[model samples]
Target: MDYSFTTIGALIGMAVAIILIIKKVQPAYSLILGALIGGVIGSGNLILTVDTMVSGAQSMISSVLRIMTSGILAGTLIKTGAAEKIAEVIVQKLGEKRALIAVAAATMVICAVGVFVDISVITVAPIALAIGKKAGYNKASLLLAMIGGGKAGNIISPNPNTIAVSEAFQVDLTSLMIKNIIPAVCALIVTVIIATILSKKAGTMVSDQDLEKHADNKKLPTFIQAFAGPLTVIILLALRPIFSIVIDPLIALPLGGLVCAIACGSLVQFREFAEFGLSKVAGVSILLIGTGTIAGIIKASALQYDVISLLEMMKMPAFILAPIAGILMAGATASTTAGSTIASQTFAQTLLNAGIPAISAGAMIHAGSTVIDSLPHGSFFHATGGSVGMNIKERMKLIPFEACIGLTSTIVAVIVYLI
Candidate 1:
């Protein structure tokens, strides 16, 4: 297939898949079908199309296997009440007067340890929900706080997106973290403020009496024991540079789970928690695999090259093009990591050639890619909804608005970086 046809076909496939996803189609079907269409149009061979789809799915599963460990850790925390103990301690220390802030702060710290946003949401939702009930805060506000803070950490910390950008630019992890720290902090602050305002304006607050029903009376774990698991994982991640060791999430997370289980005196229940955790994450895992498949197909089609070529031919300013590219790709893939990686790979050199600093360009790309990945169809959105006990329609009422705020913050970050 010629470059022009392949390019147009790939674009069409992406558009179709994104539209289907937005319309509430299952990502598995939409992405697979989209890949098939692109493969057929680009390669003009039926066998190649099937191979591409299979290979794409397999590759995605391999890449994300470590992330699945997070699910096990989440389950252990929830089952043992360790997560709730952490939340209780935070609220107790900060007081109900600053309840919302406490929740946001806790969420930021949890996600900053490089936990997946979906897993973070799942692990924290019960605790946040109970806190909201006791404090009479709006449930939506609590949910937004968790999501926003988690997303900020997910995008900027030593997670998949940061790793992807760091590799793409050949920069060290510390450098990427340094560049992203300010923007991530800014985004988190904006999200918390917006969530609080929206909660008050919507009057979605629950009565304390109503909240009592959701409260658990189980003996809360000691602060040190409750926090031991997450702290261990965080410390391990932090020591990576000093030890020159890669702490794979797969191993680290399971080890954390074991530690947390033992600390809670529930070591025997570890197997049960692991089973439950895998079940909770099963659907999301499938969705991620599908997303990876689509990403693989896009790569195989050499669409990134065509996209870069088109942008170069248009002579668009790096500042102007960077955010747009980040938003579109991130939105389409429903993954900040995939989007940032694509943007960096396609445009990092372009921006540098245009006299933009690599650090600044990377931060811009990372910020832009993250904000829109919280779209209603994204896995993070669904996970939050399920964790908070809200249905899709109910979630749609507020999630999109908050996500728009997130997108705006990132856009501001882009402008600031450029300036």
Candidate 2:
């Protein structure tokens, strides 16, 4: 590939941003500085840089503002004890004798329907701990199962990662879901098996007295009421094809939250939930704004074309190159959505050039990026670890195991797509 000063400069800026993020700089600030560096060095026009950044942020807001609805729904679910209720019902149905499997299954279901993993962890941790202790299962094993199952579901679900990929690559959402189902199920099975093995080895016993103390005392919503929000979102999204209903996730999520709120409590409760949800939106919005600016700068510089050319010259097979690109980008960014967006933008044409189908390529990218996104530095890792009461040292051991399982899942997806 031919070297251009602008392309080299853009690459350096991205590297710098990643380094800063790894060093614990706030992502929004690091990404903003990175965008400025790329824009100034690449185009040498400060006015254009500022315009692009503003326009990009505006565009991202229009596209992604609905993320707030999911946040609101998450908050409401946690505060109302709906999420715990959902876990309770699942565990009850699965029976306490198989608590490990029950926790994995429940988490998989919750995440597959678009609940955020961190929110799910916070909501389910108390119940999971109690269940594990009661069943004489290892706490670490149960936590890993919850994390792994949720990760597996998120990879294939119609969540942010898939939505970003769909927008970036122009892939069909329904087709993506259909293609991903088998791989997702396989991944979940793998997670359960791994957790079961670990539980057996740990072999920690729990006292009935201890289980009694940890028993839930919160006034939980009914099963139907508790699940109303998430179920509504899932059903609407699924029916979009048959009904041609175009249920925007932003609208669907908030509507679901409303349903749950009204079913379980009053408008007053919902107002508080909305406020908490908006607060959740604030942090993510800043990160997206920065990422959007970087995307705009990359586009302005036509850096994606150079990236495609460079990959073409490498002559790597799609099956091998796709996952490697995914894991590296996702690992660095600590975001599956960001990784998918970058890969889809940078390599869509490259995959086509290699005779790879877009659907398969998208799946491979999703799998690879998702696997390593929960690294120690990732917000999800911190949030999940904190929710489960695991200190940094304890989490350090568990996180790698979870990441390895995610990597294995990604490889399974790659192989499935190839076949």
Candidate 3:
């Protein structure tokens, strides 16, 4: 039922999807169309094609649910004023002179609490911009700083990309999260340093002056109330690593949201906050399903066999190939979740079959997915770049720095895998 005509069929299907995505079609719709074409061509059997696509989608149901609930936790973190409070404290302690580090650190923390990377950038933009202005740093530097931090945090956080890869590889969520921390920290440090260097050379870049500003007078939550929810999530999720307890992210993310709702006294507005978070990831959740369909088609195709054969011919290790697969796919899709999802579903099994450890391979692939997940075709490129008034040329500047940060984690993961 799989691996026969996959090479040509999956190639054609993926080509169609990439073209549609480039033409500004919604990724979900584009991917769905890709699946239909790929399915029919790969198997020439309508019933088998439908079954394969459905099976692939069904494979992602558990992960998708976790992603949706993460929206609840991420939403509550923002709605409760915790995200801002955390950012403000970090920037204040570091002082304006260290604004680049301060902003990147704050963003890393905010995103560590399961906030999507694009939203994390948007959330940190105001503070980053203000501090950059005070410190004579350009908008591009600040934007890059925030983005680099986001890329760093995303691999370790219980974000959709993390969830998809973890589920695909059958690794424990907490174990996967815990295993990635050191690599994330290393990547973050590199990201901040690069961004700081970029600031020195900013020279005559566009300013943030024309960007519209908004005001809010809502009472800020006390520091304890603000920090409590995220801290609890981290603690509960860490038990598996620290003490061998097995709390799944699905359990931890919603529980953290509930705590945030209660501690921030936003329990009354719980529904609204949850809705807000879901709204942000609504497109992403659908995109995950769409990627799943493509993943299914590929699974039934011979594309994987060809790729593995090439790797073997080059005497490449599966661990190294794993990350490359992730980087390329995510780069192609311009979305981490989709990239990691497809990479894991299509290649993780192959890697495992080649004797790579699931958790290690999963960790490497997860980091690799973040490396180029923000390409121009995806919403992340426009949404994040547009948020800070970046035109196409300006936005392109951030890609290399962002990739380096993610690549740092991926390299560290490869080392860990080898060890």
Candidate 4:
């Protein structure tokens, strides 16, 4: 892919941003500065650069709103016992013989219902540690189970990544999710397989000393109560596509939070829980704005067409190219949402111009972002790794497992969307 000065300059800007992120600079700041740098070198117009950044940020408003609204649902599940109940019930029903699959299923379902992958991993952590201790699975394998499931469910989730791609491609969110299901399920299956194979090794469980134990005095919500909220949210969101009901995610997501509380008889706690969820929204919104600047710079510089020309020269079709772009961007950032954001921003139009449908293109790129998204630099790696008590080496050992799981899903999407 030979690039003109502008294309190369734009890439340099993105690289600078990635470098800043690696140096622990806040992503939003890194992105804005990077966009400015790219504008100067690529387009050589300071005024245009600022305008591009604003335009980019403005483009993200719809996705940001949807993402913020999701916080209530995510927060509700996290603070309430609903998330635990969902995990517990799934693991219990699957039984010990299928322990790896059970853990993967629990984590998958939790994230699929709109929770963030990091939160999903952390929520499943204590449970995963407990399962490892009881089942004598390796701590690495247990960590693998939780994180893998998080990646699996994330593609179809109503979380930031899903929202960003859906909006970018100008497709219905539910339609994107429907397109993502096969990929998500394929990733889940890969998680089970990899974790089970890893379970065969002689290894330590999560350190018993640091493991959080459940109090026998704790009263868990009934399974029915646990299912009530997610089911309600799912039903409501589905009405739009299934029956043309026009309930927005802003309404559907928070409503599900309240339903979860009511079903669990925790209406008294709803205020604090919803507040907890909304509190996290501002930070995410800021990160997304930063994401937009990068997308904006790339768009303004016409980086997408440069990429498309390169792919054409290589004789690659746009379907594979979109997923590859997602993988590289996500791997560079070590974050799914950021990766998907950039991929959709830079490549969505390219894919569309190449004759791929919006829904199909969005699904492939979203799923691809999950590929290698938990590389060591990303928070998902550190946060989930810390929760399961894995050291750097132990965590590093599982990168292959993560990549395999992610690639499996990407492959599924490529096949499904390659029409």
Candidate 5:
């Protein structure tokens, strides 16, 4: 892993890209530029830049597809009014003094569902918003609640990312969860408690008039009715894989998404379905492409390989590396799911192949992913911020403490795993 001009350039480019993203520049474009600059720095030749960028683009295929599928499915849920129905039911249940806790709990539940479904923004936030308005608190509280819940689940839930990482690292889900769930739970509890205290101390109360004005007044479908669609898709997706036992995620993803769409009554004849699907494709595709491209870039640069090498070189104790890597990657990626998934699947797997303990590797990977997942720049935080209307700065104040619970949980899990 000697440093080359290309390596130095890539590092600088990455820094620039991060700064741009922080400045609110378009992520896709920023990432692309970063890749280009990194390539140029590494090779020091104009001709190499084109090839490097293409290499980066090529690498993103899988990630892009995953994100695209998730986005479109999410969009379809929103457009079809399925998400709304679910959110409505959640709001009705969050009815009084313990309103904050209700929102937190509901958000967590919805996020857990989102892990399998993969459209957390649409899946978790609408319910949070409805509940927040009902309880007369700012949308930020509700939004953060949803975010914390979803973030916890994103790392802990049955996401392909989680599964992929676990399997790659030679660990089981049960082992990882046993060690990680407590921290995730604590983070969420803290988030709700903080919101509740703030709401009360600030004397935030929604008047009857305001509540009535905000109320939809439309009768929603029953929870069973609403849950039926997603539930069906989940079962089928589960079965589809076991049934085939050789299916790829790309095909399976759309299959599950389509099924969910149909279950939610999206089958409004071929022509209408075609039209709606077409309308949504652009946004969804962009999101997918962006993430994929970034993933591709990482792959192409052999960062995963390099990271694994670095980890091997560390020669640190299992207890130490797991939390350190998890925290660093989570902070770097702004996604526990992404950070943990990548590190686990890449670095941790490499370590396991090198004969590290499976449970230790598993616990560490989970620890790394969850701790960073709580950061302000993380995707979950951004989605929560958008849902609640808070800027990153405001979110920073509360989110870190919640995330710490996850970090602490991860550390404890590692210690226990080591023992």
Candidate 6:
């Protein structure tokens, strides 16, 4: 016995769990439970089970803390009314005819920055929520806009997810980002168009009275509060290649969040700030860290051989399999890097063994990954949707239009790859 569960069973279980969670099962609980099951069945020891759980929890430590900091930063911004001011400035510049453009622009910037930083829904959601409130815009629509922005960045940015995926595929991060930039730009245009049409139909019912009531009255804190949130993250990312000489992004994420929080004013007490950070970050952290750890445990425990054997079945016809697998991975993991990297490595490798051009295989998968990267479980989508009070179900309803945007982008990507 090679000491692994049946391949079919493992695949089926993974598929079921992924679908169920994507469909609406709480990810944190589902992931924890799934890891437990994997531990018990794969290893058969309580002590090992305990270690698996601990490791899973441990993986989230850095991400969770960073998210918490983001939440606190967001809270501070809101309580201090800094976000409101920024929105006012944005609205002033864009005027009525181009508010949607501003929204799209903000979303793009956030998503781009997110590529190299934490990009926690916890952090992004609140900021979107405040913008939505101030502008009388439909929250869901705004969030979806942000999703388009964030997901686009995730595939190409130097963020952890992209880095992880790129490393797996042995590709350069800047090259990947550059290669995908054209399609990403096209996708962004589509997203903006969609947001504009939807915003018009979603019918901004936000009354002038309501906007006035929530507007920020503060004179503004140091330049930090004014330029915090997404700005800081962007600056950090721009300097990251050189600054990795100093601290890691994981640490920088919280540090950025903390700077935002302190600059936002007295809205959040130290304790409240702490609590705010914990709750916001906790949900996302558990999902990413827990699932990541479980994947790690599977690798460490040598269960990947079973996965490898199954992948062997799809060795020929690299183009189709690569893209399909990449899309599937993106949809399942709800992360750009995870999906693309997995597809590039696993599917591309299969093709390579058959003497196929790995670039064609990699390109197809990367295309699919871009589209799949916008799933409901994706933090970019969730955070954007959540920002506008559009929870998962309502968000899913918008999938058709989003899918169209993604489809267009994927087609373009495929064409580029083929050419």
Highest lDDT: give the candidate number: 3
**Pairs that collide, model 2:** none
Give the clashing residue pairs of candidate 4, or none.
none
Off by over 4 Å in 3: 1-4, 204-215
Query: Tens digit of lDDT per residue, candidate 5, span 133-226?
Result: 6557765455555555555555554454554455546454434444556656766676677666556544323344434443454444456645
lDDT of each: 0.69, 0.72, 0.84, 0.84, 0.54, 0.54
Predictions: Cα RMSD each: 4.1, 3.3, 1.7, 2.1, 5.3, 6.2
Model 2, span 1-419: residue lDDT tens:
32222776677667877888888899878877887887788778788887876765665664366666667776677677777788889988998888877887777777666566666666667778788776778767887888877877777665666766665556666566667777777777877888888887854344455456556676888998888877887777766777777877767777878888887875578888888877765676677777777766665566655655666689745456567767877787787767666666556666766788888888888888867787776688788777656677767777677877778778887888768
Q: Which of candidates 5 and 6 is the stronger one according to TM-score?
A: 5
TM-score of 1: 0.80
**Residue lDDT tens for model 1, 1-419:** 22322665667677778888778788767877776787678778778767766765675554356556666776777777776667667767887677777777667666665455666667666667767777777768888888777766665565556655665566655556666666667777877787778667654555554345455677868988878887877666656666767775567777888898898898999999999777766665676566555555665666656666777789866465567767777887676766776566556666676687777777778778876776666677787777767767767776575666557557766767856
Please, what are the lDDT tens digits per residue for candidate 6 over residues 99-173? 556655544544453322224333344444455566666755665566665555554454444444444455444
**Residue 27 local lDDT, model 2:** 83
Residue-pair clashes per candidate, as listed?
Answer: 0, 0, 3, 0, 8, 2
* Over 4 Å off, model 4: 1-5, 213-217
What is candidate 3's lDDT per residue for 183-286, written digit by digit as tens? 88888889888887888884444355633362356677877888888888899988988799888777888889889889988899989999998997788889
lDDT at residue 176 of model 6 (Cα atoms): 53
lDDT of 2 at 45: 78
Number of clashes in model 1?
0
lDDT of 6: 0.54
Error of 4 at 412 (Å): 0.7
